[model samples]
Target: MGKTLSGKVVVVTGGSRGLGREMVLAFAAAGADVVIASRKIEACAALAAEVRDQTGQRALAAQCNVGDWAQCGALVEAAYEEFGRVDVLVNNAGMSLLYPSLDQVSEAMFDKVIATNLKGTFRLSALIGARMAAAGGGSIINISSVEAVQPEPMAVPYAAAKAAVESLTVGLARTYGPAVRVNTIRCGPFDTDIAKSWPPQVREFMAGHTVLGRIGDPGDIVGAALFLASEASAFCTGSTLAIDGGFQ
Candidate 1:
């Protein structure tokens, strides 16, 4: 983590909190200038200030709703305007809304899930990846979920979107290979703010079901994220790295 990403400019969507926030801080601490993008500008600005003060790295706080195509474009423009170039793009923004049942799921609900989890990733990756490739080389990291492979009844829309994201990762790698590296981190349940909504029994079940006998911490994602963002994963692309503590 010592200047591993020195002089690099990284943009992380949904970077104001949770796993995204962890990656933003890690990237900044590792010597990368970061652009923190999220719907919450206040949170983004607060984190950006923390990064600058603590890590001594340049940080730009941007308001971006990745679900919207126009906002995605503005985010890319903002990052480039602030940093001149982007060396890493992490498509980390995502959402999963609960519906009463499959039949009760409204079109808006389904669309929103797809837009945030899948469409945004595609748009951002396409925009930034092209620049990365043209600039010689760079890395694009897509944050996926275990739901992509193991679909649950309650989160079908989210699972479908994430599955598309996995496929999108491979397609993007092929599209921007030999220069721009594209990969996915398929994650399992983590003890983040989201877990606060879970009942004690649910949490217990989640912990017990994982091979590690515990849910992942927010920082658990930092290692894989750093590897993918830095030269440690130079030969990796179009790969899915599972950081799920062996969830089965």
Candidate 2:
């Protein structure tokens, strides 16, 4: 069989690092031209070069802070100008700042968390989803979190924002469906470059909660993303997929 995403154009925000980076490479490997966006243009450009060299897929790097609604529009415009159409949009950029305590969380920190996680998802989905709707159809994958439903201490604002992301997934699905599809991936802790900084004990504790008995490997998510991005999921929409290794 042919590659599932061959000839597709995929735009991935936060494409410079973590799971987003993995998905960018994964999609490119499946023969998709990729547009990678991050606040750091240099990092995105570096990844773009790597995608072109490794997969021979066209790659464009755009510096876009999705938190800024304007940047989201510009990013989409650039992608369309370069590729004519975007077949998939992965709303994957997010951040969680640690505060010493709930009481210590400042207005700025809370707002930043919400803006990055929630508002950014909204802008991207609305902008690209509308375009997808108008252009017949496309797939939109929102990277939510297990924290959205299972909120934890120290990242309250982030959890709240991701909770809103799940809501966005359903709403966008309804608004754009019949052609366009919208979905969410509720991610669990994963073993990525970011996890290298996590304390060893915390890693062990997280492992204890999963049926798989370990954190997700970076490539573990590629199958789920590809399924949703391709015709294999033609009947699925407005769904929140838990890519959390059956967390308990």
TM-score of 2: 0.98
Candidate 2: where are CA atoms >4 Å away?
none
Judged by lDDT against the true structure, how good is candidate 2? 0.92
Where is model 1 more than 4 Å wrong at Cα? none
lDDT per residue, candidate 2, 36-155, as tens digits?
A: 999999999999999999989999999999889888899989999999999999999999998899998999988889989989899988988888999999999999988998898967
Best by lDDT: 1
lDDT of model 2, residue 116: 91
Question: Which residue pairs show backbone clashes in model 1?
Answer: none
What is the TM-score of each predicted model, taking all chains together? 0.99, 0.98
lDDT of 2 at 76: 87
After superposition on all C-alphas, the RMSD of every candidate to the true structure, in Å, is: 0.6, 1.0
